[model samples]
Target: MGYSRDAWGFDEYHPVAQNGSNLYGKDGIGFMIVDSLDVLIIMGLDEEYKTAREWVANVLDFNQNSYVSLFETTIRVLGGLLSAYHLSGEDHMYLTKATDLADRLLGAFNQSESVFPIKFVNLNSTSRRNYDGSCLADIGTLQLEFKYLSHLTGDPKYWNYVEKIMLRIDELEKFDGLARNYVSVSRATFSGALIGLGALGDSYYEYLLKQYLLTNKTEQMYLRMYNEAITGVKKHLLKRTNSSHLFYLGEFYYYNGGKKTRFVPRMEHLTCFAGALFALGSEKIHDSFSEENLIIGKKLTHTCCEMYFTQATGLAPEYVLYNTNSTGDTLYDNGRKHNVLRPETVESLFLLWRVTGDIQYRQVEFLYLLTFKEWGWRIFQSFENYSRFPEGGYTEIVDVDAIPPKRTDNMPTFWLAETLKYLYLLFEDPDNDLLSLDKYVFNTEAHPLPIFVPSEEIRGEGWNRQ
Candidate 1:
């Protein structure tokens, strides 16, 4: 029902082999849809969650061998359902589905190595280690999910395991206190010389520092690491091209002086990272006594809005070339593949709107609503008609213009959770920033904090320390 052949025009090549079982490429598209739910709910959009939850429950199952990427599916769906449970108090049928998925995910945790891969493809098989389990780049994202799991199950292990993973990732990222995309755990070498904050890397840093503050462990090292990552993001990932701030795809440093290349930032990458930073910064306001930290949060929120959103459409490109002057770069002019108006970017916009009473945020959301009503409806109709993303979520590696007329299986659910949650909070309060704070949100790792307020309160009432 989620991605049916009728919803898409699937015929011979990309046939609907198993009738929603193995519809897309190894259930990768399934993961995306699940991720989308997470993002929507977080944004405060309840309807999206209901739709996505129903979609996941009826469409996907973990029993199939083809659904190995279900590890992420486990976290998102379970995490989302738990959030739903939190919202409704009365359990939904979907919560059972989530609990079942959680049991499967716990089984997938490798006690021997203490590492979770991108997914649970094979248990005893080593062949699934494509990036040597480095595929867990954004695995830090599970921070909130893990915390939620611990809260529900009354087991600290879920939160503890995620924290260990964060510390492990922190050690890996500690070269000059900035995180790199790829790391060879076996060889202890950072291979993916490309440095930039795609969703995964960027979110990890946000959680790391934010988690430390939540746990009352915001030491100098934590601050240093967090600041450095932000500095690196601002310095390397951001670029100004003809009055537009473009986030590059990825950067490859030719330390040996070979051809240097940087990819433009994809829509997926920017939307997720921007939201993560906003979430981390928004937590500062809850501290109440820390005006300095609150200011930092305000700045981060402001930057995210400035860099990503536009008046034309809340929707953004799949990717933008960092250096617009260069024509031959792969990062330039990548269009939209999956034409679906991803709800995740809208979630980021809502988060800022909720924090500051900016009427412009509503304008942005209105633009998105208009876009969906106009062009995006076709994408949803196609998704309902067929199974693909109308084209695909990617557009020529970095381009978003080329809509292949089919959606993929990689929807970011955090977008759903974040967006819906923010919207819900906005309607619920519309004023107090206090109510919007995530009580036990994830830090960079899976560490569950009682609260994520600032470490020290800065009383700037009368002036300087001197």
Candidate 2:
């Protein structure tokens, strides 16, 4: 029997304060609140519906900042609000806030030259010493935001801004059709041959293709670009190990190779790339996306399953070894402060399950459930050094050593929203569908329920169904 909505109360699942039991315990109630909203949206959890609403209210209070960073303040927070509104169908005010942020963020765009500067204004001085800071992923992130804005408001300016950014990407593609890992918007040229598709690159390609597909527009140039990007990833970035599984190379061109080169399958980038490919391939289940597409998806999915997923732990590694087609190492990247066991991987597993309904994914999730029970939840690093209660029940952890000894307090909502969304969808009927891209959500208070868009109605000439 299915877990009934009313039986799924969240109070017991709620994190405790300072007793040190799990990551999401008292110190991480914020994440739990967001996760609760995700659960309600996907699974319609009747038990904590009221609590979920209250949780969002709390997040708004905690996240309030006088001067927020672009990625942190604008993209992430706005993304969280949009997601919350989609689930709760309330908080129309969030739309205004998101738009206001978007307006400020747009000023960061170099419309005169059709590109966006990496930093609207660097709040951190680390990069101020040099004019060499850029993030390729933000281009894709901002595009998605603007696309959503246009869809929700029924205005073309939002998408127009995104298109202008696309024009910049088009210019960058001329160098063998590979987008540089970083570029100077002012110079309008690539800095190096370095490239990647897992995080920044993957989403960049996704926006290009998905935008075309969703808008009923297709161009040969886009097809060529997408093909090259995917193919390049397969050649230089992807590798099949002797373990009969595949993993992407951490450093494609080594943005800063040699001594300064850091190459590892960052959990964030890997999961995002894999999830996008899986979802994209699934969306084209009935279309002709080439045998290679399906095979690539299947192979990549299997590889990701093997590389990061440990059925024993149900927790995917933050980084995995991937150097050959025969065998690769499974060493964790513990040196970096950002490398940590994340809840997002679990969410990716849920997404894979939604796409393929594969029993393997469920079994994998079962492992994750066990891992959490055993390892316990440790929330964010505190203000004081690494001093923290390892046994805390916080929902999100900023770093693996988030004890009071290592002290760093930062919480982002993507994990909360994505993880809960995955869990909710996991429990809900697989037959249920998602909302149409054409119809956008307007508020956080409440939004229309996701409606399934029939795959059959979507037709493409010369696209194969088999």
Candidate 3:
């Protein structure tokens, strides 16, 4: 499939057959390619990395009049550049590009009248798109990237803006320490009481734990909030399959002015990240909750893997619904039946493998790859139905259960940046220790940022004291 763009560079390919006609903006390909740069470097493709780096340094322009998703651009492009810089021996050019991109992104948070950052911003102009408000993930996931940028550039503005968002969120009233998924910046209030470790709220909790690690466990607030949130999650969202006894995190929907809560027995492939994150946090803190957190992490990991195994294609769907009333058999929800080639499950597998050193993780990784390749070959044979064969990357599976499971034309940037890269790192060497948990914290997009240490030691151990 044609992955390269003739005009806008590398943007998402909405298959012509799928009524995807417009490129969001010019120069999106540059953003897409950035996601793969670190993967190339990690794989030791020096020549390819050099070629890509030169292209980015020379041809990539951010001054296009394009309205970009603030969250997507920051995580994929800014996060990618910073990760590449660190992994590629602190390349100055990568840092320069990242700074330029971040400066543009800072415009998203420049709204003085608003309490939260706007979701999208026009790169070439000072125009901001208005939406209801940003989600928890959008506002909270910015800490790792922005904080690391501040450390690198000695500009506190980056960290301050993101930290302010976190503080604002912390001030909100939470249901058992869990905030709603949607919030209104204008009203400074949360909209829905329904909560899940899925799309809108997944990274909020993730950043909480990660921000603590990124700050060298110096900030007691982040740790305190994260611990509270996880405690609430286990109490409210954790559930088990009635028949299989498999543990999965379900969504909690509250009604009647928070007096009643309903459990939605559904899980997203995205929530799988929480498993690895829990395990990583437990390993790092070594507190009283460490052992319990590790157990929860392992259980969640197994449930996520079962999401793949139970499917006809041996690949997990985008989302799975469990029967909450009876035996809790997995039920197919048509809306989310497609597998978008997400990496969260594989990402968790990689992390758990590293954290636990269990050979079973490696075995699961092999099975995932096998399923991916089988689907890849099927799509290649039916090239006309999908796209041209031998494209540089893969696309999403429309229906994992279909006989010749349908394929989507669009290939997401994260496929390169996170999914494939995670798989590569998982098999590179179990003992590589390149991204040791004690030293680096991965952002929501799986970009590894080094843990910060203050020049002068602080007085208290903060959350680590326990």
Highest lDDT model number: 3
User: Model 1: per-residue lDDT, tens digit, 18-61?
Assistant: 22232334543344454344345445568756766676667656
User: CA lDDT of each candidate?
Assistant: 0.43, 0.43, 0.74
Could you tell me the lDDT of residue 122 within candidate 3? 79
- Name the TM-score of candidate 2: 0.64
Between candidates 1 and 2, the lDDT winner: 2
Over 146-234, each residue of candidate 2 has an lDDT whose tens digit, in order, gives: 65556565666666665666666665543335576676656655566456665445456554554444433333444555666666655
The better-scoring model by lDDT among 1 and 3 is 3
TM-score of 3: 0.88
Ranking by lDDT: 3, 2, 1
Candidate 1 vs 2: which has more TM-score: 2
TM-scores for every candidate against the unseen true structure: 0.60, 0.64, 0.88
Write candidate 3's Cα lDDT for 195-214 as tens digits.
88999999888888888888
Which candidate's TM-score is highest? Answer: 3
Native-to-model Cα distance after best TM-score fit, residue 413 in candidate 3, in Å = 0.8
| Window of ten residues with lowest summed lDDT in model 2 | 375-384
CA lDDT for candidate 3: 0.74
